[model samples]
Target: MLAAGSGAVPPVVWVPVVAWCVAWQASLQHEVIHGHPTPSVSFNRWIAGPPLALWLSYDRYRATHLQHHVDERLTDPLDDPESFYVTERDWQAAGPVGRLVLWSLNTLVGRLVLGPPWTVVRFALSEARAVWRGDPTRRRDWIRHGVATALVAIVIDLGFGVPLWLYALAVVWPATSLMLLRSFAEHRLAADPAHRSAIVESSGPLAWLFLSNNLHALHHERPGLPWFVLPKIYRANRETVLERNGGYRLSGYAEVARRWLVTPRDHPRHPGRAS
Candidate 1:
């Protein structure tokens, strides 16, 4: 916060650093959800509960992500909360502009650039509807999130004197965008459950940014494995893992961009099913 808020701070440098911190926090939260260094779920939640991204609550994230681990429903738009696919009814109801936007979002560049706000808006509307319907669970989740975020707000706004706009633009947006890069082609529709997830073979800082989740298929195969051990696990059974995932592989994000930066990965509508 000081780096971004201090008068001497250079935004060109500090902004990206702040974004990386936010992204790292998100990666840590993913780790916490997966039962990382500790086994206590509540402890992990407390450790990573602050809403750095500002749009999502940790409870909601943990619950939905655990559901996403059900490999059979990996790409079922209605069943998997994380799936980006739309049901046929929703697709049919959408106007031309909405269709275009959905299709554009399937591309890698579009997913990185536009996915964050789209996701936030959709999540907010759904939660709003849930509250309107008097969903006690949703109300409880938001109340807890509000309490946790109060601490975060005090630290960022009052303690550090960092403006909300700066934090949102520099930290939250880019962090969410970084996550979109990992999720852009993480899964797709397939007959085989194992084939649903794709593997992006990457290491170094980018891999660390996602806590080695770029090797997505292996992570899904063994969700209990900690992030640091994923590479060792992948190396131990490289060929088997690749074959299990039906050869859905990419060299890295560079390959993802090269292949799908402009091209839509798949149709937005879920295939072969009624809405």
Candidate 2:
């Protein structure tokens, strides 16, 4: 049903609401991938595959994210696909403005304000360049992604009667907000793989929103465990888990917002040495 006052509601409200729902659905996909909601992996993927988050393929993320759990090479710039660190050489190569932009993205506000644009634009440009160069991997990735992109365009154009660009701006901005919150303090490139992931001690409302992924250490340790069961397992092993993570814990997002809203968590130069 079309909401009666939705048309008059500010873009801020609808944008965030759509983004939050999408983010929650993405969390559900993560849960499905971890064998939650069913024993059948393919079935779970089917249900969770529609959203096509950050324009990424769910199967591809599953493969890469599982490798990330290996814990032996937590945030090695090359080995960890999710590393945010720039190599010293790259740091030196950056211009003044480039360096400033990099630093800004290292903070919470920057991640929300600038991260989405940076990520999407960079990826699209790189993909275009790769296509020009005839990169097979890029081709295959895009071929799979193209189908979903077309579907997303059709839904926005036909269903909402909104221009593709407007729909994108509306969806991507607030979706990145949700992503930033989940990932903002999830890790800090520790010396040990076991200690690499951070723990949000009490996520409360956000925990359910993230499908209990706030208990990230537990998820990393046992990815097969269902989302609903994670809280129970975490509670049972809270002391051990905290010790294993080298006391890298936060009260919640409020405390996280208070401490690191504008500050860098650690020096960008700190090598994520395996301990």
Candidate 3:
């Protein structure tokens, strides 16, 4: 907060540093949801601190992501809360503009450019509907999320000298986009439950940003293991990991970009249930 607020901070470094912090907080949120640094889930959440992503509800994410770990439900459009695919019924229900938007999101370029806002808007609308329906859980989630995000804004905007708008654009948006890159191809549609998750063999800075989750298949296989140990464990059982995931591996995010930047990574429609 201080670096970006301070006039003396590096011109280029402030944006990325702040952005990395936001993204790191998001990774921390994921870790907290997975029961990290403590046995108490509530304490872990407080330690995870403010909702840096601003648009998301950590409570809601916790509920959904735990559900996402059900391997059999891995990429099921109807079951996986985080599934990128849509059911044939929904696809057929969507009009031309909506279909085009879904098609664009299937590409890495469009995911980077459009995913965050789309996610935020869709999430907000869903939450609004839930609130309207008098869902107490959604009400509490958003209430807490809103207050926490406001606290973050106050600390950055008022306590420090940074503007919320600038922070949202430079830090939050890029942070969200970076997050999308990690998730962009983390899973694939596969018949075998083990093969649904993918492995990205990247040990660089981005891996740290994702808390070593770039070794994704292993993370799914051993979600209880702490992030720091994932690499060591993965190395020890590299061949087994490869075999378990049916060799669904990528060299790195660079390869992901090379393959799917413009090309659609997969149909937005879940092929197994497609019309």
Candidate 4:
């Protein structure tokens, strides 16, 4: 797959393939974070800590994601570290331009188009601010991230001769965008925690790509279940799963795109709390 004309990997082929690898790596990271295929946490972290996307550190992502697994805090803008929802105060503080961008990002297509850069910038800024404020944890994470990212740079740029700029723009950007596709509507604002996450009743390649995370409600309910067995478990108990989640399900990603490609799925502001 790496071969191309003139003995160099062409950008067209190289970019998409790397993006797929990176997105799949992110899925593997989620699997590793959930304690899959292994009993040792350090081993899992080591196996997935290559900075494939070059923007997020594995340890940092794992930490925030575990925090997100506090099921009762699901979709709470302040409580859930992974929530896309903005508090009313933040939404109002973001003037017209920021609000417009946030609104566009609510659409499935717009999320894939704009979410990657927006998230990376926001996360980077937050981490920078945290470090500036003398947050020791953030400082350590950034330091470790720098070392890991530098190692990845050496492998991709020096070892394989891929330019860092091309890697970032072509691989990291598109990979992050693909991740946004899975996460676009994985959760929505709801009063009940059980009702926040959705079930994507899909059995296609995207489901495999996400490692069965498309059955998001099931994964949330049983975090220790391995990816390979999720479809089996869900098939055996579909009704119970659906009933538990209040029937929040999508037929597939295509259905999601068709329904919310143009319209914003929900306002970015959390509905339960006033500004």
| Best candidate according to TM-score | 1
Q: What lDDT does model 1 reach?
A: 0.87
Question: Per-residue alpha-carbon lDDT of model 2 for 208-267, expressed as tens digits?
Answer: 888888888878888888888888888899999999988888888888888878987655
Candidate 2 lDDT trough over 10 residues, lowest sum: 1-10
List candidate 3 segments past 4 Å from native: none
Backbone clashes in each candidate structure, one number apiece? 0, 1, 0, 0
- Model 4 agreement with the true structure over 108-192: per-residue lDDT tens digits: 8789889999989887887788789999988898899999899988888877777788778888888999899999889987788
Ranked by TM-score from best down, the candidates are: 1, 4, 3, 2
lDDT by residue (106-126, candidate 1, tens digit) is: 998788888989988987887
Q: Give the lDDT of residue 164 in candidate 1.
A: 78
Give candidate 1 regions above 4 Å deviation. Answer: none
Model 1 lDDT at residue 31? 95
Cα displacement (Å) at residue 89, model 3: 2.4
